[model samples]
Target: MDGVTVIDHPLVQHKLTIMRKKETSTAGFRRLLREISMLLCYEVTRDLELTMETIETPLVEMQAPIVEGKKLVFASILRAGNGLLEGMLELVPSARVSHIGVYRDHETLQPVEYYFKAPEDIAERLIIIVDPMLATGNSSIAAVDKLKERGAHNIRFLCLLAAPEGIKNFQSVHPDVKIYTASIDSHLNELGYIVPGLGDAGDRMYGTK
Candidate 1:
């Protein structure tokens, strides 16, 4: 994929395998998601611009590098995205947060937006949209649509799993935004679920059907 980056870190891959197992408990699934998300966050922000700042060393004064520009904005796509958001926050506690409430309509597989909130200076920050699964891509695309309407231009999308169909669909709509994921599964099933993917992430994490 031209605009996609697959996080193949060994720890991430190992944890994802356990999360995919049907017998894994909800607690286990949620724990692994949080743990893996930090690793994903590491790669996603690897290229962040940096600026040198004056700092005091044990023996002398020196210039140290720090992240440049405004703090990042992690735009979570409702409930499931919060799983990834939790760990990313642990890694980047200073970053800002944004919540975008969008869900896939079971019948139409379209996105329905219910809530949205973000920092007033969102347009000046790098927004990273978090979601567990990019199965049909409707919800992610819609969330981006909403963010762009608010003047967000520097944006990235992060997810635990993605389907080829979903990637194609998302790229078609937002080619400028890059995507980061733990894995790209085979395909989407008829019900808009990623094939060979960990089951509905929200259901697994929350112990719901």
Candidate 2:
């Protein structure tokens, strides 16, 4: 909990509840995810550095605050991470995008990376990794490892739901990166899935399963 921030806005909670229902249609789930992600994005980037820029209003000249430094990078962890990416991009249209393809080996529950593409100047900007569920934390950790190997120093992890086990594992490996989630669930089930979770986010998002 030391490095975690929970987005408990009423709208976020309400949307999450709808998403958690098994009867929810794929279209509904995707819509709520995008809506709630925008809210979560608001909280994750709350502390971004700001610099005032002088601008002339119709009435008079004024200084307005704008984000400082390079555009933030949203590094999505394969398929499911892309769900959060849409709404986040809607909020920060100028943010750069990174895609890291990593998947869990169902048997071993270990991560395997097959694809990765990111901006060349990743080291110069903030990277926020998005994944819907931080269940075992293996894939998330591997994704962060890939980013750090590419010289990313400042990083954060954002997810729709997190398990205590996954949170502990992630922090143990990458304590420097903070975590942002809409909810910290009860625990992970034996199959490496979050209990009472919204089911396979990638499947639910795309109507695959």
| TM-score (all chains, Cα) for each model | 0.99, 0.99
lDDT of 1 by residue, 74-176 (tens): 9999899999999999999999999999999989999999999999999999999999999999999999999999999999999999999999999999999
> lDDT for every model?
0.96, 0.95
lDDT of 1 at 152: 95
Tell me, what's the RMSD of every candidate?
0.6, 0.7
Q: What's the lDDT for candidate 1? A: 0.96
| Residue 17, model 2, lDDT | 94
Clashes of each: 0, 0
Candidate 1 regions exceeding 4 Å error are: none
Tell me the tens digit of each residue's lDDT in model 2 across 101-173: 9999988999999999999999999999999999999999999999999999999999999999999999999
Which number leads on lDDT? 1
